[model samples]
Target: MQILNVFLVIFLIVAAIMVERTKDLLSAVIIFTSYSLMMALLWLLLRAPDVAMTEAAIGAGITTNLFVVVISRTRRTEK
Candidate 1:
């Protein structure tokens, strides 16, 4: 349990950095979705199923889709 906690913390830190440092809008959105999934897992491990489900739905599902849509619409027309 303790080892898993430490690893989870490290993973979260790395994931957060990846999400922020990623330059491509599409890649950033994907990373953000993954980050949300990680957060949902952490919430589940903390025995908060409701919050986990909410995070999964709102953060991973809806928010990610919205981001993708926005990015797709705003994609630059490279000549």
Candidate 2:
């Protein structure tokens, strides 16, 4: 449990950095989605199941879908 938490935390940090540094908008969105998922898992492990579910639904689900839609209508790479 402890190890899993630590790994997820590290992945979150790296994903965050990658999202910011990435030049491809779609790639950034993918990384951001993963970051949200890791966050949701962390929240679940922390005993905040309600918050975790909300984050998973909103952060990973709705937001990612929205981003992909917007990206589809525009350029996929940063200029």
CA-lDDT, candidates in order: 0.84, 0.96
Point out the worst 10-residue segment of candidate 2 by lDDT: 8-17
In candidate 1, the residue pairs with backbone N, CA or C atoms under 3 Å apart (3 or more residues apart, or in different chains) clash, namely none
Candidate 1 lDDT (Cα, 0 to 1): 0.84
- Candidate 2 Cα misplacement greater than 4 A, ranges: none
Cα-based TM-score, every candidate: 0.88, 0.96
Alpha-carbon RMSD, each predicted model: 2.7, 0.7
* Per-residue lDDT over 30-75 for candidate 2, one digit per residue giving the tens place of the 0 to 100 score: 9999999999999999999999999999999999999999999999
Model 1, poorest ten-residue lDDT window? 70-79
